[model samples]
Target chain A: MSIPLTLVLGGARSGKSRYAEGLVTAGPAPWVYVATAQAFDDEMVARIARHRADRADGWQTVEAPLDLAGALDAAPAGATVLVDCLTLWLTNLMLGEHGITAAIEALEAALDRRAAPVVLVANEVGLGIVPDNALARAFRDEAGRLNQRLAARAGRVLFLAAGLPLTLK
Target chain B: MSIPLTLVLGGARSGKSRYAEGLVTAGPAPWVYVATAQAFDDEMVARIARHRADRADGWQTVEAPLDLAGALDAAPAGATVLVDCLTLWLTNLMLGEHGITAAIEALEAALDRRAAPVVLVANEVGLGIVPDNALARAFRDEAGRLNQRLAARAGRVLFLAAGLPLTLK
Candidate 1:
């Protein structure tokens, strides 16, 4: 059977990530987690550690700070794979000075080739006032574009608010 | 007939304000625009000006920098009242050493007393990585709480993404 893809979108503390994790864990065992976050600071390190502690044993974690497409290709077939977030992956790519256009194309291709069910988490960052800085504005615009693209490709999309899930697709 | 209260939420540049304006304009001839923004910078001045220019005549604008409840109470009955935002008013209250708890209480009370059809706009800012600063984190938390309260009280809540409105209530 073809694996269905789902996208979970929410603001910070909206429980989107938890919801996505629940979806993957509900379907199969020995899940593969594609972690895109990089611990660049103390807070992030603690956050990452907390997430690690939250998951039960039986899950294999891949540190895909970049090369997300490759990480997807590496996952075992018929296994449930969860990409913790796409925004952090985008941030990593931007900070690393990678070709964002080519990276997005590759990531889309990877999603198209996946044999296992996949759940992706992304932040909904475009719903606020325009940031004062040009960099922040650009990032917000880029994130919106990326989300639109991903939402279009996914079989289902869910938006989280106040820790509640509202299916969008 | 009781006037409808609409809560319009979206990310930056998501056309949320425009959408809210459309809602008010669609209902009545004369409109009460309850603007919560304080133009503290040139960019903001330009933004406010742009919004002003975008509207046709017959809009009576109320500059509610801190006294939002009073402004709302003063709006004409049987007219459309659009509160451009709540987050900025919260920021103003926080910065001006005003009591947030009391302000929220007053705002809620005012919403309860409105005699006109009201459409409120607010930014959804709780999504994304946690802010590094304590002040920012506090602000995000407060925004989230305030949004939940207002959303629960609102007759209808709409989340805007990619310029599309998805009704949540």
Candidate 2:
């Protein structure tokens, strides 16, 4: 079967991650977890620690704050690679010297070249009042664009809310 | 000329709102800013105040934390409607009894039925490390999926980073 590309999305407090984890558990092969977060503060540090404790010991955790393309490349073929989230990855790229276009292009290329199933998680942030600040508004705009590109490439799309999964594509 | 549907995306401080305002400033009226956030706390109250103070007198603001389809129906046919962000809207839906699927379907129908040019802003949250907590992971997953569905419907997609926009579609 052709490798399936799954994109999971939801708002805060939604149960998308657990559902995705369940999918990974049921799937085959060497499981790889691609993480994109950088603990910048105490709260984030604690958050990271909590996530680390939740995973199964068998899964190989790859800390990839940025350059997900490279991380995907290094994973062995036939492995189920789960990129925990895309929003943070985009944040790292936006904060980095390399532009957003280049980062997205690289990610798309990596997804296309991969032979294994890839499950990517991201946040839904576009359903609110327009921010008054310049910086907040810009982030929202870019994220909306990035999500569109990734969604178009994904074969399966799911939205989770209140711990429920609703398959969209 | 046909009105263009614009997608604005960003993170917490990525400047997505201000950029969208700039776009509106250059476009035709009657311009409507659809506010999808609810003030549930002191921090949110302050954030909302900050956003309100940033707008020009020419823009008319409409507060609709839920029932976005109804809100869209109230907008003028030829006017420009800017749905500030999608994250908060999803949050509102999750907090409600209708759940994710119904909310998504309603929003999709609204987008399809609307005649006005709609500019949507959202946050991209899938880049970081997998959250150790089940709740955080679930939120990340659902947000990613919602973003994908909306992005697929948007005509133009833009990714913002460090206040810069990279057009992807």
Best by lDDT: 1
Interface RMSD of each: 3.7, 11.1
Model 1: DockQ against the native? 0.19
lDDT of 2 at A148: 60
Interface RMSD for candidate number 2?
11.1
TM-score of chain A considered alone, across all candidate predictions: 0.96, 0.94
CA error at residue B111 for candidate 2, angstroms: 17
Please identify model 1 stretches exceeding 4 Å from their true place. A1-8, A13-157, A162-165, B1-3
Per-residue CA lDDT of candidate 2, range A1-169, in tens? 3558988876665766667777787887589999898998998899878887977777899999888999999999889899978888877877775588887888888888888899998776654444446666667667766766676677887777788866655
- Local distance difference test, each candidate: 0.84, 0.77
Model 1 lDDT at residue A106: 99
lDDT by residue (B65-119, candidate 1, tens digit) is: 8999998888876678888888889899988989999999998888778767788
The interface RMSD for candidate 1 is: 3.7
lDDT of 2 by residue, B1-169 (tens): 2336788876655567877877877878888899998999776787788888988778888998987888777888877888877878877776674588887888778777777788888877676456666656666677789888777777888765434465777
